[model samples]
Target: MPPMLPPLARGDIEEAADACAAAPLLNCLLREVGEPTGDPGVHRLHAGGRLLRVRGERRPARPEVYADGGWHRLTHPELVKLAAEELRRHTGLSNSELPTEIIDSRDAVAALLAARARATPPAGPYLRSEQSLITGHPHHPAPKARGGGPVTGWLPYAPEAYARFPLELLGVREDTVVEEGDTTALDTFGEAPPGYRLLPAHPWQLDLVGARPEIRDAFADGRLIRLGRTAGPLWPTAAIRTLYAPEDDLFVKFSLDVRITNDIRRLWRHDLLKLRRTDAATASAFGAVPGSAAWLSDRGYRTADFAFEELAVLVRDGLREHVVPGATPLLAAALVEESFDGSPLNGLTDPSAWWTAYLRQVVPPVLDAFARHGVVIEAHLQNALVAIDADGMPVQALFRDAEGVKLLPQVTRAAGWERLVYCLIVNHLMELAALLAERHPGMDPWPAVRRELTRYDTDHGLPEIADLLTSPTVPGKTNLLLRWTGADGADARYVPLPNPLARH
Candidate 1:
């Protein structure tokens, strides 16, 4: 098993949870609303003008707020309160939901920490990496909110808890089956009755939405039947809704009713409708790129007409075929997450070489896809898989998540470019760079990034590259503000963050 937070007493677990939860909240508060106070690791809340001090950079912890002429340490709840007050004043808006989510996120972390102490982490590097993100989405205000549900409801499927279970298969009557693209892979799970088509559902999602009147009616009317789960256990990846089946070497993504990070994780109709086009464009772009980089195609989807979104299952190409033969594909997000026992980043001896190889594998395909095919992929950490050779050097990059891909003609070039810059440079590179810099002090990681971008721009002649290199600020997603304002989940709002590429 990969190393876990040392088994802790209940009090210690809560204390550790406080620190675990505070980092991302502090990051969000500082980025979206707080201003640096010029004192090291100190920031002034822009609205309330309160001074807050924190230690560490990659994952800020041990928050202290200035009051009574001295620093007072804050519990995670206090930190949440301070953030809520600041955001409320900062935006002239009150949000009951966001504050609750912040608290729930902290509580959820506590549960995951405790559960992890008792659970066994997966042995394989890829599965370990996929399940290793305890502090998920380092910038989101409530990265692990879990829909504010009871622990029992989510703990069994949580990746951070190292949970693995069989998918609950259901048989959708053949007459009501609605599918597109190639869904043949799904038939391998189980055989349906003569009149039914096999449909696999996430157990948690089935529990959450199966009781709906429409769904219940279908169940009663013989349109849906409960088929047994897969014989083997499937490992839940960081994206809680997606599970990887080792036996079959497949990834099955199901509609999860819970809200994870920014949006409800249901396979919405709109995205499903466009999945084929977006995925095809992405695959085409990767084919054109002259490297080992690959696109893990979302092969197809299967669902019932009566419960399309709830019963939807997406078939994705697994790593065995796409990854380089001798290399192991690790989740990109896991490399930057708090170090685990088998983490490749933790064992790195040559930071520069590792980073250079990483940049070469990750950066080129993204730029080429945009310039040549007009496909803007969400190349953020969780969606990217970096395969490393025996020496632990990054050799190949595999990008996924067709739902997040944006076609150029569908969105204006300017809008698409902003989204691309936000995902690739800001969300993906910035986090990894910060983690690398933190691990290896005095190592400036930006120059290599700048060089890679410069080389790509030279070849592709993308007009935005020159401006991006010198731009004073790059777009940073405003998750804290977005959540507080109750904005549409798909609507992206960005704040200007100091561009490190400019400095390099």
Candidate 2:
């Protein structure tokens, strides 16, 4: 394999997005490990760590091992040193054994593994990352009956990053496997099922997926289009569906669902459509410069289509893996569908607090993306992705799931343009303001959030976020409301986040 690879840079596209979500660790890893399986557009590396994979023989590679909250603690100091050495060794392996270039996944592995390890609890597998709870085999946490054809299961939980790599490393042939009852285990990096499910990326969706073809192309790419589990009548195909035209990903929700109230549904729906609309208008469009679907709207490309299951899949895959930290709502979800790992913020003393501050600070630049393009967006937590660096500092804010972006028709009409202020500022930003007020008191949270957004319009005439990466750092990192907690004990409702523009 190659000894060195060039640095990974969001340098152009994401650089202009927002500095808040930028991960230099991603950049560092790319320079170190070159790349790993799948995801060629980017690079990867063999970051060393005590990774623990636990899947049955049938679904061995499924991240249900790690993301199902199945993680093993890497508490031993010796294990940490070994991880680094192993990564260096892996990067030096022969190219025929494992190519050193691709989407730059190896670089992310260690950082991500470490972050997940930090999230692990001290006592049991709860915080340590365990896979024991995900399998459906008789010995699995949830045993299946012999009469089952296929268990009727939908992961109403946090999804893990696709558990496909370990299998590829083991040289498993995915085409021949993927049966309902077949199982295998792998023990290369620690523990794993030598066999598993083979749901690889569809070739046509490459533009959006960004996973490497060299590794995942075997599952179904060139084959016939395979449908997932059969759909029942109750599944709302009309609105729940999503559309993807090449680099585009769009979704919508009809007026339904018993558990969701009109307020929640309305908020959810508005954020959904508004986000897509906003991204299509701005640089949030997927797979392009200065865009992430939310940015695409600014360029004048409308949605190509829609499907409920498709949207569900998007949400599922998205939550499973993070393109940028804090961007996916799956960050807030306690339930997991698929599994994934690699969070830069995992080592923090107070991870929840860091996440809270992350959510609060992210709204600004996301709303700013709209302002840069003379557009308005529904800048809410659901609409934004929060990114924290290795040190747990909030560094980047990228928006996706376009359905949440909206251009205030009223504001646009008044100025002979779409009212970005209404959608971005009033509709979306205001709601988050309420949340910050209720969920994270103190520190002029509303103004602090607004300051970042307003700066885009006032300073650079609303520049896209990429340019902000190299730009100056804003103030406010200390929260004045440290003494205040929204609710106490296990019912604590508020988050402890530092003020983004704080002098502290």
Candidate 3:
């Protein structure tokens, strides 16, 4: 068992929850629909020209609107209303669901806070970093909304709540099992009876879809049977559906029926069919790179022929084999989203050297893969992990999630470059750079980033790099507008952000 956290009062939890929830909503409203005024921390709504004031830089808070001849503070609910109204007017689209999700996200944070106050964080640094995101996706409007379901239903499995539970196991008859490549690691979880294959399921997923007619009929006809659960518990990673089994050094990703940040967390068949090809290309790219950077491949998947989507489980390579010896792997998202007790960012003694090490480890591989292999990796914060040695300087960067990766001929080079900029630069590097500069006030993080990218461009001969450095703007994903307009999760829509590289 892990060590327990000290309890906090109800009032403190509510206040913390409000602050956590408001930051993302305000960020979205400001970036997507609100226009900045000359005054610091103040913006004018693009639709109505109403002036709004905020407090902080990274995580903006304490919102106030100038109305009725004075500034009136807005609560979390009021802020949500203001965002909805502004988006409705700005886009000329009315969305009743997004407003509810914003409220649901706030409520979910409150529940997570209360549970975390009484829960135990894992002892290992990797798992600790994986489960440390209390303020997830700093720019997303409803990053924590858990399908608007009851707290009791999701709190037990939430990564933010430090959840660890044994996977529910089942046996699929040989003829009914559908598998791809290298799924042998899953067999080690438990022994299957005579002619059945071992298939593990996320308990929450089964609870959501088990009663479907097809699944119920499979169990009734003896095509599937219960085989009990693993003897040990698996730690849920930042991506809540993916869990880590330390004993086996394996990651098991299940098909969850809930909607996380942008998409419903199901392993769709279209993506599953191309999984092997995608993983192979990514593996080849990383293999050719002459560095410690690695790719944690999604080796294979297993499912029942009858319940292909709902019962699917993917086997991913674990950290033990890829990470450098005597080093610890930490989630990139945790470094910027929230700092824990063992966080390397919190323990930084030489911020400039540490920032340079981080840039070297993280930047090259993504660019190399795009330029050399024609493979575009989704190297966003959650998909990347940075390993650090005893003194807390970065040593390696390992990236995962082949399902989100795009191949060259499948998408145009311009489109792939846009995505790379959004994921690698806007989402991953910008947040970390801002956090480092915020910590060390005198440090200018952009020059190091500019130098690193310039070296890569000089050797790789990618023309986009020159334009990127001099361009007035860089692409930023418009999550709030995407959800409001009900766009497909894969159909990325972007807005422009002032390019820090251009200024540096």
Candidate 4:
């Protein structure tokens, strides 16, 4: 059995987990519909008329609400109940399921915290950074929800617990195999019998779909055969479905049945069919951009015809070839969350200089990609990778995940621009800026962001740059409202929030 976590009172563990869970939900509730009540820390829910407040800006904690003539502290379940009541009145729509997910998300965090107490983190800084997102997607209410599964079902594959395991190798009979683009890397994993092609599978995914008739039929008919597991373990990255094999310098993205954050983590067939086109466009766009910035291409994917979406494995370009020499690549989300071990942001003595270097490395590539190539890369925190040199300053920016990439005419320019602003500015820059301001109090990071945008305006001459600089409000994705309304995860809906970068 795995070593047990260090002894802690169960109440203490649950309290920490509740705090972890409440922050994001409160963030969402406050951002979407709650009205500020003069006091900077307090807000009134427009729908339910409940007064809510918390401490801290980046990661709000110690939640309380005005009730029964005094402020009452709320437990995780109580917070969920408040959220459900407010969202129902605000949206005028009832949702029973989202409330459960909010609770499940809190429970999942508790499990992760307990498990992490027992396990050792990976020695490699990169691995440590990838697995450090205990409180993920700061704006999403249920960022840690794991399909409400028991801890045993999902904990072994969780990145938060520093979990690492071998990829399950399989042989797909050539006659029944389906593939596109360059999947040559798959063959290097292991050998297959004659007339069979090598295919690598995430063991967790295989377990999820193993009982299906098609999978069982293939196994019995000799159309599919299990070879063995990989010799080396693959580390699960911040994006749970994607695994990195450090030895081979390779990334394999698999289909997961569990709902993580907003969506069921599956590589749907439609996205797979269009992967090559989207990836090619992004690659070409990056090639023309002038800098050390890189786009990790999703080269191709392979899966059995019978279980296309269920078993699909996408091969993405690894960091080895793209990263600057002697620089370590860390997940931007982890860095923003202050979860990355030995984070450069923590050691910054010169806030302005470090912030400038970050904006220079990250801003230009994203703007150039959109303006020049009509490719609106999903440059969100999770998809963006920042490599820092020995001196602990950002040296390069690398972006990944072709499925999230959107081409210009495919989505109207207006729609694409909204997404770019939301992903790049609101999601990526805002979080980093908040954390920076929190660490170095009274430092306004927005002026530096404004300067970066100003430079982009001078270089690119895009009208949206000017509009963004002066706009009072910028789009913020409504994750709580989206889930409560039962909207598709991919269907993003945004409402305006006060834009910090806007000129006062």
Candidate 5:
């Protein structure tokens, strides 16, 4: 039997959940629509003309809005209502869905908090790190919203709750099997019938799509056959759709129809079709880099033609091969959240040295990939893994998720560079810097970042490096505004934040 979680009071759960949910919402409101009010931890919301203030940095909480000439503490629902009203006025557009999502996200956090209180985190450092994000996507309003489905539908599969389960195996008929690249790792999971090819599916995904007529019809016609679940359990990662199977030393990404953060976490056919090119380009670029930094290649994918997006399973390279020997690999995002058991950032006496070492491992590979191969890796926290040695210092950086990568000429250099800046600087480094600075007060992290960038000789080529170092504003993605305006998640629109890297 699983160990019992500590009993949590109903009121405590609600308050904790509200805080978790409100932080990201408040972050979005402040970033996209508010300006600093010259008071510490206070900003003026432009549309509502209301003064909003919150206590704490990184994860802002204890929200209060100025109204009726006095400060009023806003509940989770009130905060959502305020955000919706401000966004509607700011964008001059109405979105009923976003407001609903905001509420759902808060409720979802409540449920997760309750569940986690009773559950035990995974034993392994990597698995524990992967499941550590309770307050996901620091800037998105609905980071934990699981398609607004009931708690029963998604709670069992949530990483934050430390859930683990076996994958359902399926046999696709030889004629219906569609695959590309090195998907051979999948066959080892379970045996298929004589004439069929093995296709592993996430049970949650199967539960979501199994009832469809097309899927039912395929099963009836012997185009698809159930092969039972894998004996070994696969641990869900921070990205809910992806699972890490320790036994096989493999990572499998599935097409989850649920909207996670921004996009429906599905393996789109268009992305799958171009998976080989992108993965190969990334692999080659990392290979050319002169260091231990590695790329966890998306080896390939397998799916049935009829249920393409619904049934897609992507095979990503496991960490054992790419990670340096004697070093442990932990998700970079987990480090930002300090979610894992032995985070390097925790209890650091000299953060300056540690921050410098981190920049060395992470920054060079990204710059080299851009300069040499024109491959812009989405080096956001979730996509990055920093492996550390016995002393908990970074030795290697490994990146994954080829689907998020953009090749230079495919998107113009200008566009690709912008995306790179958002992912690398704003998403990855900035978050890490904030966490480091918060943990160790008086450590100015940006000068080390500036020094690292200065070492890169972009003088002959990319001028963006110089511009970035001296620029007043850095790109910050507007998640709340984008969702409110009903824009496609991939169609990223950035607003400018004061750049800390700029040398004054």
Candidate 6:
């Protein structure tokens, strides 16, 4: 018998696929894989999430959810389709090896066991106290263990880890906090100056930062670290932040330069917000939406009683039970780090590694949130956060960069021009897909993502995310990396966006 999965609902698999913009293959996994024994071996798959499992010596098989009060046998061909789709989605093989291609239930179960056998508890991402932010790998132990797992600290301020990093490695910090009229700058000391407060940093943030830090430090002491002076990208190039110490338990992202501050404001109020209006309208048609301010509140997952602008908190740590690693335990799932290897997938050829997490979980929620709330959110990768679980399954997604949030011009009071639309569709989605492909190695990934985007379009009325990726040449040069169009708007045929990083 094949071993079981984490007792996932057939529904969850389907739901994940639906959001992934990869439903056909996801649906196939559920149907073909059958019931998850938690044992990986054999099972039956059914649409609408019917699952069945194998029993003892011809033991009457069991049902995860018995529809007619009994287990039902599914055809073998059905299983083929399911597995084929997953294989296609993940590995994208042209033919099955029944020899090389056919993955027997026994082998599948063994693979799961192997993964679990190698399952080491994950460490806390950052150590924190009431005053600082610290960094550590989920697999790496904390500088000092609290108990079994590791103690998490919360700090009032994030120290300067970036300060220690080489100047070429500028730490880009993007976070969410309330904005009143329309402007918020990166924090300097730690807490939001007088007008703002720090917000919660979601795990999905794992993939956000582009310039990788040479070293990660979470100061237990109140000491602050800063990057030594060097040169690479210009300061005002984008929103760069300091550090959020996990040991100290607070994250700080500061921008000493004013240009970084102004750009953030312009991107949000003038660009992102304008896009949100249209998004909110289009998303509502499919039942996905969220309040504009409330959307930013997602990182902290709280509603601001006062205006969002009135509540700017730095990155703060939530209470976590420190499980000291003595025996085996489940660490949070999905801890893959998005780093660039100077590979084709990086911005030079495709997207950076960060977008992989976004494609798998984050973007979908933003779309659904905006649709359900009758409010628009700029879901482009810039405004999105994506995180995953131990097994690499995506779980949490948060949206920030409120200035980017927009109200559809035609549908609401909010109005903006092509830049908003271009950014949301072309700039964001294309970049994310490119990044995801970079991380997975051999996978074309872009096509699988497009497959998923197509699934999204089948349900929601928006253009498949792919439709927006466009090149800048035809429209004349612009600051955006690339440009694309939405399927809903112009009547012209689809055109590919020229990637700023991709050169002839």
Q: Score each candidate by Cα lDDT.
A: 0.90, 0.28, 0.91, 0.89, 0.89, 0.30
| Stretches of model 2 off by over 4 angstroms after superposition | 1-259, 263-279, 284-364, 407-447, 450-454, 461-504
Off by over 4 Å in 1: 1-11
lDDT of 2 by residue, 226-310 (tens): 2232111111111112212111122212221111101112213234434334544654323332422222132111111221111
Rank order by lDDT, top first? 3, 1, 4, 5, 6, 2
Residue 78, candidate 4: C-alpha displacement in angstroms: 0.5
Cα lDDT, model 4, residue 122? 94
Q: Each prediction's TM-score against the native?
A: 0.97, 0.30, 0.97, 0.97, 0.97, 0.34
Model 1 lDDT tens row, 60-171: 8889999999999988878888988888899899988998988899899889887887988898989999988878889998998999889999999999999999988899
Q: Predict model 4's lDDT versus the native.
A: 0.89
Model 4 lDDT tens row, 118-227: 99999988889899998899999999998887888889999998999999999999998989999999888899999999989999989889889999999999999999
Question: After superposition, which runs of candidate 5 have C-alpha atoms over 4 Å from their true positions?
Answer: 1-11, 458-461
lDDT of 5 at 265: 89
Worst 10 residues of 4 by lDDT: 1-10
| Highest-scoring model, lDDT | 3
Off by over 4 Å in 4: 1-11
lDDT of 3 by residue, 161-227 (tens): 9999999999999998999999999999999999999999999999999999999999999999999
Q: Give every collision pair in model 1.
A: none
Q: What are the per-residue Cα lDDT tens digits for candidate 5 across 320-385?
A: 988889999999998876445668877777888888889999999998899889999999999999
